[model samples]
Target: MAKQAKNHAHRRMTHQRQVISDCLKTLNHPTVDEIQTCVIRTAPTINKATIYRTMNRMVEDGEVIRIVGDDGAFHYDATLDAHYHMLCEECGALSDVDMPVLPQIDQYFPPDSDFRLTGHDVIFRGICSKCRAKKAGRNRAETGQN
Candidate 1:
């Protein structure tokens, strides 16, 4: 079961919610539009408002995490594990970064501050290998170099 939403009862997993969750897991990191597009394949009647409400509820229930991509759109992630991600600047691709979680960084919060540091999000931005290769190929073609 997903974590309960604060001040609200735990929402039961309905058929539509299950479908949404499964789609989220299958996707690497997808935005609402991407998710809705994928969802319509299995659930033809699901609408945009339903997707929005369900996603927002999932986030509130701790079943999903919303990340803002370079494109300035909200991306959904179901992987609750503590890890970072790499966003491809060239293609707007988002993928998990395979590395250990730096829990030590949590200690950096002001020692005397009253606020508690719950978590942190680290996103590395750059041109992914595929994008770099594509660019390189284009440059080579333009320059008449093999």
Candidate 2:
């Protein structure tokens, strides 16, 4: 048992693995490029290929989840539970939405709809607070007052 535990720990604790895990733990949803930047700061010797491979391995091992945004970029989430996310369209901010329970939509769908409800992702896309503030500033500037 000890040998097996040690082996498992070894499998999960490479230099790139540690850097990838650290990057995931620091943010809600970070893109590969973002994570690569962070990893480079800590482990300058690590390259982009190592970061990508480690992240992919982590996803395959169920240590992380990959979220594809509308921008065609893949974001990594360290949380491995069933949950939803909201993306700010203007600022590209990603946030998690808390739910007491998952909504029951099976009752609303017809049996012959051919849509299997294995899982769902509810992402609310809207302008974030910072973007709203920027728009307000622009409006003020255009009004030539304040």
Best lDDT among the predictions, by candidate number: 1
Best by TM-score: 1
Q: After superposition, how far is residue 84 of candidate 1 from its true place, in Å?
A: 0.8
Position 134, candidate 1: lDDT: 96
Instruction: Find the 10 residues in a row with the least total lDDT in model 1.
Output: 4-13
TM-scores, each model vs. reference: 0.84, 0.80
**For candidate 1, lDDT tens digit of each residue in 1-146?**
34446324424337779889989988889988889888999998888888999999999999999999987988899999888999999889899999998988988878899887788889998899999999998999989963
Candidate 2 lDDT (Cα, whole model)? 0.81
Cα displacement (Å) at residue 65, model 1: 0.8
Alpha-carbon error at 74 in model 2, in Å?
0.5
lDDT of each: 0.88, 0.81
Residues 90-111 of candidate 2 have per-residue lDDT tens digits of 7677878786435675466676
Which residue runs of candidate 2 sit more than 4 Å off their true CA positions?
Answer: 1-13, 113-116
